[model samples]
Target: MTTPVLEARGLSRAFGHVLALDDADFEVYPGEVTALIGDNGAGKSTLVKALSGNLAVDSGEIKFAGEPIQLTSPTQASALGIETVYQDLALAPHLDPVQNMYLGRELMRGGLGGAVGLMNVNEMRSQSRVAFDELGATVRSLTTPVGSMSGGQRQAVAIARAVHWANKVVFLDEPTAALGVRQTKNVLETIRRVRDKGIAVVFISHSMPHVMEVSDRVQVLRLGHRAAVLDAKHTNMEELVGLMTGASTKGAA
Candidate 1:
């Protein structure tokens, strides 16, 4: 069997006296979408923060590509090919897709010491276009600033940016939260594309239908601890909800 792309064992975190995450065990496999679902204050965000290196874990182990890793910062996670796209969609509204895609990690023609020192705008644009195309995104102009795009378009840009840079896993927080039906479909399709490309995806969402539609497995968290994990094919929304609410015991295989 192929090893998991990202795995967390005995993951725990706390804020002051409040335990935000408790012994959360999660695993994501290449080319698969794993939905992390829970109600408000269920520790989904906390788990994500720890997994993405935005917050330190009190005790736990994270293994990427089957090897133990210490992720101290978001940059460290990115360096290890772990990219996270939060609900806020962190794009500069004033910048175009290409610029936003390459925001901090802009491609330069050469190092500062090199004779040719210049930003590679053309290279960034070309790559951004390729990334969007791969996801079947309908961004007419890579030159159009993100603020001018619709919410779905902005979400697409964020996902595209992650795909362009991430080599291992991607974490998406509430990807379709406020998107219209069509826009949500677009975003979901882009997620499918990401999974098809052999990238492990940890999708966090509250919409049960969306979770059932796109996820291979569903993991439910309640009060900072894992409630259950169920196979999407084998469970229904009611069952999932029940598990999340501590009313049922069945879970994903």
Candidate 2:
């Protein structure tokens, strides 16, 4: 079998005396979307923080591409080809899509020693459009500020940025939250496109129907522990809900 793109074994995290996450195991395969579902306070956010290198793990191991790695910071995670799109869809409201997409990792031209080093604005604008197109996003122009775009458009831009830059895995937190029906459909389709690109995706959401529609597998967390892991094809929403609520066993009923 091929090695998973990302894996966590016995992963745990704590804050003072509170155990935010117990020993949790997860695997994300290439070209698949794995949904992480749980109720509020189930440690979903905590696990994401640890996996994305925003919080330190108290124990367990994290392996990326079959190699053990210590992710000390978000930069380390990004360097390892892991990108995260938080619930807020972190984008500068005042910046255009092209500018927001190339915010931190801007492309530049010219030699390191010369003053010729300048932001390649044209290249970024052109490439950003291509990425958006690949995701089936009908972004009319990349010059519109993010704040002026619709909620779905903003989410699309955020996802496009991750897919365009990250080579390994992408973590999406509550990606479709607060989106209208049409907008939600658009974001979900974009996610499917990302998975089809052979990049592993960790989709975190509380909506069972959405999870069932897009995920290949589902991992349920309850009270800081992994309550169950099941094939999405074999599980129903009731079973998943039971698992997340800690009413069902690991394999669900």
- Estimate the TM-score of every prediction: 0.94, 0.94
* Per-residue lDDT of candidate 2, residues 1-253 (tens digit): 6799888888888888888888887788899899998999888898888888999999999998898999899989998888999999999999999999999898886576235658888889889988888888766678889999888888888888888888889999999997889878987887888888898899999889999999998888887888887999999998998887777776521
Clashes of each: 3, 0
Mind sharing the TM-score for model 1?
0.94
Global CA lDDT of candidate 2, please? 0.87
- On residues 10-97, what C-alpha lDDT tens digit does candidate 1 reach at each position? 8888888888888888888898999999889899998998888998899999998889998889999998888999989899999999
Candidate 1 residue spans exceeding 4 A from truth: 111-117, 251-253
Q: Show model 2 residue runs off by greater than 4 Å.
A: 111-117, 251-253
Angstrom error of the Cα, residue 25, model 2: value is 1.4
